[model samples]
Target: MVRITNTIDIDASTQQVYAALRALDAYPTWLRHSTVYRGTKMRTPQSGKSLSYEDSTMVGRMRGEVVEDVPDHALQFHQRKPSGSLDALIRYEVSAAGTGTHLTRVGELTTHGMLHIVQPILLRMAAAESERTMKSLKAHVEGHPI
Candidate 1:
């Protein structure tokens, strides 16, 4: 498994940050990548609720589902290739940081078949992607570009 993590502080309340996290449709406006919510089953993210969607990444379209949702606290999602060769886990932890919010993100990827051979490459890309996502998310919640 390859793991990568990143953190950022957004100048907004935890409620503000959590609201932005659940706003799937507004993702394309600030996210570095594209996550198509056109087919998402859960209109509102909540604990135990299933989330399903497809995202455009370096590896092409990938499907994912929400595995955990703790309102205003933590959120986690899992992704895997349609062919069942690769699995990825992404999670976010949110907390109140004075007048703003502290966000921590972690990403883990496990590869099967031939993907294991390129685990090192995936690690690098995942780290970069994680950073970009954090920065973009911070900006998105803070209501200005970072």
Candidate 2:
């Protein structure tokens, strides 16, 4: 398994940051991945709620569920292959920082199956991607266009 954690301070209130992070519909505006939905219905994030999503990323298309959504505090999701291989776990933690908001993201990737062969390379890529994503989140919450 590979784990990567990144933290960023955004110039916004925790409430503002939390709201923006929960706005799944606005992901494409800041997130590099183009999200595609498998189901027509969309719901807000909440504990035990699962949302299916397909996102185009550097590693290609990934399908995942956004689970364990703790309002204003944390969000977590698990990505798995159609064959049932656990690919990754992405988590977000938010808190008040001074007069702004502090966001921390943790990404854990399982090195099972064929992924073990390229684990090192994949780990580096995941770290870089996490940094990029945090920067994008900062920009998005600071009223800047990503």
Candidate 3:
């Protein structure tokens, strides 16, 4: 099993941070490795409904389901991949920090089947990707013109 987590501070309010994070349409503007996104389902901010996004990554395009959500606080999901040892769980958390917001993103992978042998490599890759995603998100949220 591989677990990767990254946290960053954004000079934005929790609402602003959460809005940017939860919107699938905003992902391409923030998530660097998510070069392509399609088949997105989302709900209004007040609804607290479910949303899903199909993201294209270096590993391949995968469908992720929003399994957990807590308004401006957190979001968690699992990525479904077929015929691979990769089972992925991704989570994002946001909280107010002074005049800004603290954001954390974690991606965990469990390897099985024939992919067990490469668990280490896969874990490292997940770490790098998770970090990159956080950096991009931070840049997007903090860089917004006031």
**Candidate of highest TM-score:** 1
Which model is ahead, 1 or 3, in terms of lDDT? 1
Listed in order, each prediction's TM-score against the native is: 0.85, 0.82, 0.81
Ranked by TM-score, the better of candidates 2 and 3 is 2
Better of 2 and 3 by lDDT: 2
Cα lDDT tens digits for candidate 2, 1-146: 77899999999998888888777667766776522222222344456557666555545556777777888898887776565434889999999999998899999888666667777877877787778778888988898876
RMSD of 3: 4.4
lDDT of all predictions: 0.76, 0.74, 0.73
lDDT of 3 by residue, 5-82 (tens): 889998889998888877877675456444322234443433654666666655565667788889899989888656
* Candidate order (TM-score): 1, 2, 3
Query: Could you tell me the TM-score of candidate 3?
Result: 0.81
Q: Which has the better lDDT: candidate 1, or candidate 2? A: 1
